[model samples]
Target: MKAFGSIALAAAVTLGLGGVVLAKPLSRIISETGLSPEDFEVLSATSDSMLASGTPRAGKEREWINESTGSKGTIRVLEVRDNCASLQHFIRPAGVSQTRQIRTRRCRDANGNWILTP
Candidate 1:
């Protein structure tokens, strides 16, 4: 009976780890960042809108907040060129003191859609 219980415990552990390993990459990232899906959505929309606006300029900053999750962030345009813009995101997860920052660049495609660029 003890051996059977050990086997069941091992199986449970394996299944739990397997589920974590199989989680979608984006979901894992969001979870790691301590941001809810709603918070991420708000951030994405705000960033895209800032980039899509005609003639983005450096020093422009936009803020986003998800009241449901209490997560907030700021997106600032760092640099702008003819077709590409680089921005910084300062993210503050709810109740967390350490803020996270992410820098990314986006360029306008021929069809006028913003695309993330390396």
Candidate 2:
């Protein structure tokens, strides 16, 4: 019985579908895209610029401008998968004259939206 329980746990983590995220079947599910680490950074920085509280829809794009400092940028959802999402954020800080790109991921919670996990 103990061994069976352990096996169940292992299976859940492996398939990712059972644990959270996508409603698709086991075969189509994945835990991570393996591109998350680098992508997630850009997403996080850009999302902060939006100053809104909600999950960005997959493929949704938004533009932002900082009125005070005149910094501007864009954020776009690259993709969304079972449990997590990939996003891109571009920013050109005021007075620096350079553009930056950041990519990041967000995991779903009980509320059914992508959010950065602790």
Candidate 3:
């Protein structure tokens, strides 16, 4: 009976460790936005600039600017599974308006390469 209990405990410990290994890191999800470090820096700068300029532009226009500039601003990592991740980017105008915009995308990290998933 003692041996059986010990074996069960060992099994449980192994399973627990496996679960942790299978879990994904939050940063990995953010990394999947197909954004390089430079891209992230540019996005942060653009967001700061927009906020400072107090521009009240349309959401579409803001998205266009971000996309054109290759910026993935304000991304939130929702989930990470295997090499794929789900993310969302929120954009808010810099003025005294309560407008908020959100965009969602799925991306994958293939062998350390990040790419947007179709």
Number of the top-ranking candidate, with TM-score as the measure: 1
Off by over 4 Å in 2: 1-57
Greater-TM-score candidate between 2 and 3: 2
Q: Which pairs of residues collide in model 2?
A: 21-83, 22-82, 39-103, 39-104, 40-103, 40-104, 40-105, 42-102, 42-103
Question: Compared with the true structure, what per-residue lDDT tens digits does model 3 show for residues 1-118?
Answer: 3333223322322233243334344344224333433444454444333333332233323332244444433544455566544444443323213423333323334445333332
User: lDDT of all the models against the reference?
Assistant: 0.69, 0.48, 0.37
User: What does the lDDT come to for candidate 2?
Assistant: 0.48
lDDT winner between 1 and 2, please give it. Answer: 1
> Which of candidates 1 and 3 is the stronger one according to TM-score?
1
**Candidate 3 TM-score versus the reference:** 0.32
TM-score for each candidate, following the candidate numbering: 0.74, 0.49, 0.32
Candidate 1 residue runs with Cα over 4 Å from true position: 1-24
Error of 1 at 65 (Å): 0.5
What is the model-wide C-alpha lDDT for candidate 1? 0.69
What is the Cα-based lDDT of residue 50 in candidate 1? 85
